[model samples]
Target chain A: MAEIQLKDLAHSYAADPEHTTDYAIHQMNHVWEQGGAYALLGPSGCGKSTLLNIISGLVKPSHGSVLFDGVVMNDISPQDRNIAQVFQFPVIYDSMTVYDNLAFPLRNMKVIESEVDEKVRAVADILELNSILQQKANNLSADQKQKISMGRGLVRDDVSAILFDEPLTVIDPNLKWKLRRKLKQIHERYNLTMVYVTHDQLEASTFADKIALMYEGKIVQFGTPRELFENPNHTFVGYFIGSPGMNLLEIEVTAEGAKMGEITVCLNDQQRRLLKSAGNASLKLGIRPEFVQLSSQSNDESMPCTLVHTEDLGTYKIVTVMLGEHSIKVRLDEEQQVPEQNAYLNFPSQWLKFYADDYLIVTDETGDKS
Target chain B: MNKIQNNRAWFLVLPVFILVAFSAIIPLMTVVNYSVQDIFDQNNAYFVGVEWYRDVLQDPRLQDSLLRQFMYSGSVLAIEIPLGIAVALMMPTRGAMASLSLILLAIPLLIPWNVVGTIWQIFARADIGLLGYAINGMGIEYNYATNATDAWLTVVLMDVWHWTSLIALLCYSGLRAIPDAYYQAAKIDRASDWAIFKYIQLPKLKGVLIIGVLLRFMDSFMIYTEPFVLTGGGPGNSTTFLSQTLTKMAIGQFDIGPAAAFSMIYFLIVLLVSWLFFTTISQLDKNKT
Candidate 1:
């Protein structure tokens, strides 16, 4: 296994692309540590596949070198790179049996027949494909075909990594869970570096130890799921990771605190000082719905707002409240008391995130990553 | 909810039945009648049954032409299939060059079969034609009108020139239909060029190849117009295929009983071979997704 690194890498489909819009992947540097399970998560067309392909040597970047274990492999072909990739759809040799499909990569590498047989049988056993080892790949179900596709990589001894490009997309929902657990087992057993590319947050969070959240072709955050939920470095992360996402409100920075039309959101003196020194920049206050507090009556630490709507989500209740023009969503416990009218909302200072220009602004005593 | 079922779909197929009655059934019945009886006049006939069938089957001239027909079709397929695949693989896949190449390849297929024969007839003439003059210039004594081998070669070459494009076009579309992911996957698997073709490309093209093979086989088996135009059954029936021999028997010599029986046998052979080919290929590809 080798650590794959992207050093100032960028890609543009056009030959002589001048504008940033032409670039599918923006200039960036990232690293996938050896033997680590990582996810490159993004929305569609945000260049997740392009990044994955570059790492696997399916694509050569336009601007920068891809380094493997500190060696430049920019000129190496995919075959010589010794990386395997499972595509969005299962790509199996239709005429070959499951045994042959699992043994394909090693056979292509011209491994001896006895060793090839050993690896094939071992991989088939792990993938639970031993039962259908003699069956033609074309007759197997899609998930089985995908497992065979994965097994092609697992059979090889010299593979640097196995990249998964949304490999579970065509699987049934229940089968996806099974396959994911199988992948986790494979990763644990073999200690192979695996990078999974997907647009699904749940899949990324569950399957990856750390996720590189990409936005507009740039990796906006690289952290654990808990870290992303607790401390979002980019406003897009705050908006993208949670179920209902974070509720952001436009505010004006001042010496005392941020002004929201008629009321003020008090910040610590250090944050207030930072805002005062920054001087009249556009600002936003972001808080996750789960973190917001609801008070039935107007109090010293609460701001009175109109209760617009309430939704029961089986386990918890989310209540939308309006403070002037901004609609804010607050999550309350299922058994928690919620006042029909005159409900007040509190944005706990510890949970508040201040954004200057769609990015989190850090100051002294800002984030409690608990 | 109660469902209405009136077998209205059968009524929708009435037009096709009427069409088949006038187009296929009546003419075939007349031929069958002609084959089964000895007719002195329209009013007088005697049952002769399978006598014509036996006579047609035992005719040595027909037997010779049948062997020649198989040889001709076999040569056509053997030469054309591989050559077409090579040309298709070598052709540009996209952009202005690809379009231009496609248009150029379609040129031969667009020419009428008789026109193709006439073109080659003059083109391969010994004294005046470009091909024959060039060959004679190269010190080869080639004259199709007098030499049986030369005439056979000329007809086969002409057919190849006229029809290899059909196979090439079918394979080109098949190759283009393969997704880029397969190539990428093959590269990752470290498959050699030949391995990629043998495993991925050939297996994927089976559907298109089946269609091309069937089309070429049937068309070549029933081939008449091109050789007929060029050779006119030759100096001594040198390039006379089965259809030409049948034509000579039916129209030229007016052997009605024998010709009808021969026609029936010929039709059955085409139908049987085509069915065999279709079944074999589809069975091999039974579990295709």
Candidate 2:
């Protein structure tokens, strides 16, 4: 196994790209450690698949070098790179049995018959496809065919990495979880560097130790699930990662602090200085629904709001309230009492995040803004 | 609940039944009538039972032409299928080159069979034609008009040149229908070019290949215009195929009764072989799926 390092990597489908907006993957530098399970998470057309293809050598990036264990691999072919990629659709040899389908890569590498047989059987057993080993691949169900495709990748021992391009798209929902667990088990056993590309947040959170969230062709945040949930480095991440996402409201910097319409918001001196120095016309304050507090009694710190609606989801309730012209959501526990039509909401200072021009401001551990 | 049977539906199908009766059944009945009778004139005829069929079956000329027909059809299928697949595989997959290649390959298939025969007839002449004159200049002594083997070769080559493109076009469409993911997966698997062709391309092209085989078989078996024009069944009847022999029997010599008997037998042979072809290929498909 080898660590994959992408240095100043960028890709553009256009023959001659004059601007960064023309790129499908903007310039970025990142390294995936050996034996790490990582997920490249993004929306459709966010260049996650393009990044996966570049790593697997299926695509050649226009701008920089892809290195494996410090060795430049930009000119190497996929066969020489020794990477296995499973595509979104199940691609199998229709005429071959599942056994032979798994054995295909080994046979291509001229591995001995005995070793090929052992590897194929071992992979089939892991995929729970041993019972249908002799059955033709074309006759199997879609999920079973997908298993065979995955098994083909697993059977190769010389592979340095395995890349999955939404490999579970065609699988049944119930089977998707099982297949994902099996993949985790295989990853642990093989200790192979695996990169899974998907647009699904739940899939990424469950399958990857670290997720790289991409937006507009650039990686906005690369951190653990908890880190991303607690502190999103970009406004896009804050909006994309959670159910009912984070609520953001535009505010103006004032002599006292930051103000929304006529009400003043609580902010530390460093945050006030950052806001004053930012000089950006657009500044936003963001907070997750789970952190927003609602109360019936008005206080000096709480802003008055009009309750638009409340949805009692079995486990928790989501309260949508209007503060001035902005609609903010508050997620309350099932045990918490619901507020009436008119209520006062408080944005906890510790949970409040400030964004200047859509990018989160970097703050020190001592609460001093950078 | 009881379901009502619609008897009025029979009236709606009457037009189709009348069309089939006039077009198919009536002509078939006429052939059967002619096969079982000794007809001296349109109105003067005598029932001869199975005598004409027995005589026609025992004829040596019919046997020879049947064997020749089988050999020709078999050769056509053998030469065309592989050649067509190779041509299709080598064709460019996209852009202007692909379009240009498609138009170029389609040129021969658009020519009428009779015109193809006429073109080859003049093109294969030893004295005036480039192909024959070049071969004769090299001292190979090629003359399709006088030699039986040369005539057969020229006829087969002409058929291959005129018809191989049809099979290639069918296979090209089939190959194009395969998704790009298969190739990507194969490449990741490190499959060699031959293994990719054998496992991926060949299996996917099976459906179109079956169509090509059946069409070429049926057409070559019933081939008439090209050979009849080029060879004229000359050089001691060496190039006389089934259709030529049957035409000589019915029209050249006007032996309507025996010719009708032979026609029925030929029709049965073609029908039986086509049924066998369809059933066997479909059975293989079912077994896999």
Using lDDT as the measure, the top candidate is: 2
TM-score of chain A of each: 0.95, 0.95
Q: Model 1: per-residue lDDT, tens digit, B38-142?
A: 887888888899999999899999998999999999999999999898888889999999999999999999999999989999999998899999999999999
lDDT of 2 by residue, B24-65 (tens): 999999999899999999889999999999999999999998
Note the residue pairs that clash in candidate 1: none
**CA displacement after TM-score superposition, residue B52 of candidate 2 (Å):** 2.8
Task: Report the number of clashing residue pairs per model.
Answer: 0, 0
The residue pairs found clashing in candidate 2 are: none
Show model 2 residue runs off by greater than 4 Å. Answer: A260-264, A295-297, A309-319, A332-340, A365-370, B5-15
Give a tens-digit lDDT track for model 2, residues A226-281: 87887987889889988778998888887766788866787888777666666775
> How far off is residue B97 in model 2, in Å?
0.7
Stretches of candidate 1 off by over 4 Å are: A277-281, A364-370, B1-14, B286-289
Q: Candidate 2: what lDDT?
A: 0.90
- Model 1: CAPRI class: medium
TM-score of chain B of 2: 0.96
